[model samples]
Target: MKSSPIGGDEHPRPLIREVVVINKQGIHARPAALFVKTATKFRADIGIEKEGEVVNGKSIIGLLMLAAGEGTKLTLTAQGQDAEKALAELSKLFEDKFSED
Candidate 1:
C-alpha cells in the first residue's frame, strides 16, 4: 500500500520485500526495538506481515504480537520518498539476523 505524500511534487509508491527470520533468538525485544528504530529514520511508512497479519513497523508492541521465531517469513512494505533505502536497510537486518546469534 502507498503512503501519503511528504514534500511537494511527491507521490507515494509501494515497495515490498520478503525475508525470513534467521536469528537464533528470533525477533525478541532487542531486535524488534532495532527494527522500530530503523523504521523511524525513514520518511516512508512501514508495515510488516506474517501469515497475512500486518502490523505497524514502528510499534514495538505490534511487532511482538507476531511472535516471529526463527524461520518465520515476513513481508516488509514501505511507501514514500525514502522507501527504497528503508527497504534495503530493513532487508539487510533480516538477512543478517539483526546481528544476533
Candidate 2:
C-alpha cells in the first residue's frame, strides 16, 4: 500500500473510513465508473473491502464485483501520499450517494 503522511509529515500510517452505499442503484455501471475516476485522482493507494473480500479501488471491474447494494457498508482504506484527502473525498462521495437520486 502506498502510504503518506496525513499532513505531509512523512508518517506511513494508513487511513480508514467506513462508508455505506445508499444509492438506489448501488454501485453499478456509471456510479462505479464515477467512483473509479474519483479514486484515481489521488496518489494514495486505495482499496474497498466488503464482508471479507477486498478489491482495488482503482479497478472498475473489482468494484463492480463488490455488488454492493443499498445499505451495504464498506471499509475504505488508503495508504501513501494524500491518504487522508483520499479518504475524505471518498467519504464525501459516498455520503452524496455517488450523486444519484
Candidate 3:
C-alpha cells in the first residue's frame, strides 16, 4: 500500500490515519481477509502501514507479511472520492476488533 504522506507536500491529495489492531490475534489471515473484503467495498484505494513499511490492505499476502501483532499500531490510508469515509469506517472496524462485538 503506497500511502501519500499525511503531512508531507507529497501527493497532490492525501488521506492517512493511524489505527490500532484491537483483535487479539492481530492481522492474521482470517482478519486480513475480512479487512480486505471490507476495503474492497470502497472505491478508494486502501493501504496499511506498520513499522514504517506499507502494503496493500486488499492483498492477503502483503498484509500477512506485515507480521503485525495484536495491539500493533498501523496507519491506514486511502485516496479517491470516498477516501475520508473509507478510512473512518475501516478505522472503526479495527476499533471494533473486527466485529467480535
Best by lDDT: 1
Per-residue CA lDDT of candidate 2, range 6-94, in tens?
45555477798999999999989998998899899988899999998999999999999999999999999998778888999988988
> TM-score winner among the candidates?
1
Q: What digit string (tens of lDDT, one per residue) describes model 3 on residues 2-67?
A: 444554333336599998887788888777888888889987888898988989877889988998
Of 2 and 3, which scores higher on lDDT? 2
How far residue 84's Cα lies from its native spot in candidate 3, in Å, is: 1.0
> How many collisions per candidate?
0, 5, 2
Model 3 pairs in collision: 1-55, 1-56
Q: lDDT of all the models against the reference?
A: 0.91, 0.89, 0.82
Candidate 2: minimum summed lDDT over ten consecutive residues — where?
2-11
Error of 2 at 89 (Å): 0.7
The TM-score of predicted model 3 comes to 0.82
**Regarding TM-score, does 1 or 3 come out ahead?**
1
Could you give candidate 1's per-residue lDDT for residues 4-99 as a string of tens digits? 465542556689999999999999999999999999999789999999999999999999999999999999999878888999999999988898
Off by over 4 Å in 2: 1-11
